[model samples]
Target: LQKACQSQENNRAGLGADKKEWIRTEDILERLEKVSDDRIYRVKDALRLGVPVNSVKKLTNIDPWYLMQIKELVKLENELMKFNIPEDIPEDFFRTLKVHGYSDAQIAWLMRVEEKDVTRQRKKLDIRRTYKMVDTCAAEFEAKTPYFYSTFDTENESIPSDRKKIVVLGSGPNRIGQGIEFDYCCVHGVKAAKEAGYEAIMINCNPETVSTDFDIADKLYFEPIYWEHIEEILELEKPEGVIVQLGGQTALKLAEKIVNAGYNIIGSSFDAMDLAEDRGRFSDLLKNENIPYPRYGVAEDVDEALRIANEVSYPVLVRPSYVLGGQRMRIVINDEELERHVLSIFKHMPDNRVLIDQFLERAKEAEVDAIFDGEELLIMGIMEHIEPAGIHSGDSSAVLPTYSLSEQAIETMKKYTAQLAKALNIKGLINIQFAIKDDHVYVIEANPRASRTTPFIAKAYQVPFLNIATHVMLGSKKIKDFEFEKKLEGYAIKVPVFSFNKFPNVDKQLGPEMKSTGEAIRFIDDLNDPFFRKLDSERSMYLSR
Candidate 1:
């Protein structure tokens, strides 16, 4: 829609009159049906291109009322092109824009200005967002649930409470890389907050999540996990602190924004997060701490990426920084693949920095989930990946109480986890990945927030690790205060479940990028038991099927 709007503006400036391109209605229907998320935008685009409403409706079978609604939004966008930011715009104009669900980022794009500039203008004009309660009853009886959604109206139903509160942001949606695992962490964190005598407020957009249930948190805000929505919620609630460490990368990306807005992050500071996320800075930290890591280098362009790959040798793992689920990650075995991967990455994310590291093939992979209270660290559990280092952790089958690692390697990983937690000042949960080759331990990466394995480990060991970490973040408990059992009696395996039938033609091979949509767990008294072997065989056969 934005592209179509820009094209219309260009045509007006260059041709001096609106010209319509004759397109078939069948093509419009094809675009609408194939691109599910952009159907409404496609309608707006078709209308902007002068596709008649009668033709569109006759082919697409969409109601005319809906088409008119989209037409209004398109008209609004055309009017928006005439104004600039912070000047020549009436204060009341934003109220209408907000009523039409125009985010500050969208307005900024239309006005060809930075998003922050639009934000500053909105603040200057005091055109803040208001909240409306999601009432099940239509005022026949008073609704007791505190669920709310944002709007540009005058009356606000979500009144601030005097009691101290902590805001927990939920992972936005369920997808291949991030799924219900992070939602498990968020739900546990909210429960812990209420148990610690503070009202818990949850901000999430997914209605399918347990955290979005009306009774899960003291107050629920069913809003997008974007910075603008989160900032508005914080502006109204003024919570004592915000917990971002349990919500996965979706919430973790907003750490700097929350800090810059003068709100307190309940756990590790933004600098710590940056230190862990920034490839060069993290490598420097590991070098200073005498930690073993794969040889790596950062790059900004194709030439630099190829140079790093040559230095690191062949079979290098390349990925963009500050990404979760190993999105756009690959193992390039030669210069040709390196150039191709770097070009593809830059084409999609032009401003992103690429991190090229030596790929450890046939190396055993393990992960550790631990917690820290600024002074002491507790290792929750250690999971050994059934597959090797190349497969993304989320897509790999992992066995808890590590079935294959030697005692020495396990101790070394635990020591490294503690050292990193203390060095990074982690107050809540931390997940660290390790690669073992020739009896040597190397740190692959570190995540300051909860991992997808958090819930799996908790269920297998019957431990409340998330609860403990939440208390640690709230400063109400320490690692020494809890009686944590690090060792388990039996073996537990987490097998990745894929929905291949739903997505036709997708490659079934697991690699650096995650592909599994969900997971299933299996437990047994012995790893060599017949039932365990049978289940393992079934899991192995799934990939081929």
Candidate 2:
């Protein structure tokens, strides 16, 4: 059961919670595995309910050592629940809780208060974290590339540098929607910052990524991307600014918190990010700009969603705000399906509103990755999706230099992209998706930071798009500073790679939700070749296992 739970945890790390398909077959083996995992938690519940460790082990075959550990943790949680704040608890006890890996959110959960209140209480109690360096050698030689981790200690080894520094938050872990792509951006972003003569610091918990390489940044903090962890690092490092845009959704979600903590977010402001992420606000912006967007409505509950579904007619696209890789996004054909999906979405995001858009069934989908420096915009690359509008862009095969769109359509897309970048007051990278139906283009969505396609576009254009965008965010470059190629000489296709065989009994159809774990690029000089013609005609290329 423990091994099964570990396997599920690993799978969850890879696929992420958001990328899971809501509708799928119920494989008994999978169900049994899940039951095993749930039983581990059920043991915790039993212990909390005053069950004996020996009884738990007898009933659940879990080792006594593990059961005792869970019992101790529950005991501590119950003890902590008696105190309202850190100030109310003993200093040594609070320190022990921190050392025991109790996050602000977890403490707040037990105390029945907001996480911020716990954080404030900790601040008032002077219960702050300290940093210690990861000594690779046995203290025989000083580690040249010093990487640090946080702990509740008095002695600190990571001394603050007086030199100007920029902190680049890294995408925490590799998941289906956001894997190595954002790490590619972070690597380049730190290099660009270093080249710009600023000491670059990177904060990330994932050791599998190149961005977490000891040599990648001048100083690396091996820490979670949680708000409390980030705040502690920022408090210690005192960086000139923090770059949140390049780290995908994980780091992007922390932008507001970083700003509220009085740290400068180097790229687009939080308001700009919010404007792009909030569906209602973005739809209003599109309307104000006279940019065509799919008829959409925001709903806070099931009745509102049903009303919007009826008004928009059948077959609507539903998604939550501020999500990446089409997380919790669905296409429903009728009111019944709408209610089911909306209810499930609400179950996950109880406080947030769901966005409903008129599903453009057969529209050609395209996206643009561009850079903006407050005043000017440069389109990095425009990719046309081979899988049409309904499929998630991450799972779709995207061809750069837009093989099918008319020149006028391309120009119009570029214009609309620039307009959005300007309206959002974007200072770095921006990605916008569009759908073309009946020869008219409509804005699908916009992201005010680097998208998964940024790296693909950079390679397609044979330019350092990430580096250029980083410099722009650092106030070191402008759109006119570098000349771009007037025309792309070749076509670059981004092909999504899936791992359907790894997960048994999983649905294998491409849809609005992203499923691909990785991507590969194919560059071609000619599209008229017989093989290329076959690929174009079929719109898919498959490889045998």
Q: Pick the candidate with the highest lDDT.
A: 1
Clashing pairs in 2: none
Candidate 1 local lDDT, 1-545, one digit each (tens): 22223222111211111222225666666786554644655565578677788866875689998787777776877888899764556777777876777767677767878878888888888888888898868888988899998877888889999999999998887877889999999999999999999999999888899999999999999887777778999999999999999888888988999999999999788888888888888989999899999999999889989888999998899998888888999888888888988999987677799999999877889999998898888888899987778888888888888887999999999999989998888888899999999989999999998999999999888889999999999998887888856445788889889898988988887788988999998887888868666654654332310
Q: Estimate each model's TM-score.
A: 0.91, 0.90
In model 1, residue pairs whose N, Cα or C atoms come closer than 3 Å (at least 3 residues apart or on different chains), thus clashing, are none
Each candidate structure's count of clashing pairs: 0, 0
Q: List model 2 lDDT by residue over 1-545, tens digit each.
A: 22122122222211111122122223322332344534555565566667677866666566898778767767787788788765587878887777766766667667767778878877887888888889877799987557888788889889998999999998887888888999999999999999999999998888899998898899999887767678888998899999999999888888998999899999899999999998888989999999999899999899999999899887899998777778888888888888899999988767678999999878899999999998888888889987768888898888887888998899999889988998999999999999998779999999888999998888777788899999999998887887766345778889889898888776777778888999998877877756446656755333100
The C-alpha local distance difference test score for the whole of candidate 1 amounts to 0.83
Candidate 2, which segments miss by more than 4 Å at Cα? 1-43, 50-64, 84-86, 138-140, 483-488, 529-535, 538-545
* Local distance difference test scores for all models: 0.83, 0.81
TM-score of 2: 0.90
